[model samples]
Target: MSLTAVETLNREFLEIRCRILDLAAMLDRLERSDDTVADDPRLKRIHEAIDLLTKSASRNSSSDRAEQVQLTFSRPYDSAWLQNLKVRPR
Candidate 1:
């Protein structure tokens, strides 16, 4: 766990948090739109998925803090090797 790894992990976590917030805002916008609510099943499904993701993220974050667990990033460089790399706090 090097400094670089820690920085990267922090960046990734921030990015994920931002994405969750953005999805929530998007869902709010969709719900408030003037279009027929029943017209698009896809939007409904997407909203449901986003809700699930938001809940999961919230749960994970709370548990992580309680247990002092640190989130890390798995390397995406190798297509075949799935378990070779991890980035965590030093």
Candidate 2:
């Protein structure tokens, strides 16, 4: 039998909480560092992903949050990616 929403949340709550705490700690560390990340594309993508999650949660949409987040960090596939990276075929 499939688990209900409450049952699923009960099973996963602690893991979810831990992950949020980890993300918060990482953000804190970054804030405390002297290195600048405001202009970094990767950090911009992280901000976009966070905004996506916040918006989706507020809407309570049934979209796949994990897939959305993953896409936020992914790039379009390039047919000449290997050539672009200058990887030699073995």
Q: Write the per-residue lDDT of candidate 1 for residues 1-90, one digit (tens) a residue.
A: 556857878869888789879977977887788885666766655655555555767776443431221221222357544345554435
- lDDT of predicted model 1: 0.59
Point out the worst 10-residue segment of candidate 1 by lDDT.
66-75
Can you tell me which runs of candidate 2 are displaced by over 4 Å? 88-90
**Which run of 10 residues does model 2 get worst, by summed lDDT?**
30-39
Off by over 4 Å in 1: 1-9, 51-90
TM-scores for the candidates: 0.41, 0.86
Q: What does candidate 2's lDDT look like per residue over 20-52, in tens digits?
A: 999999989988898878889998999999999
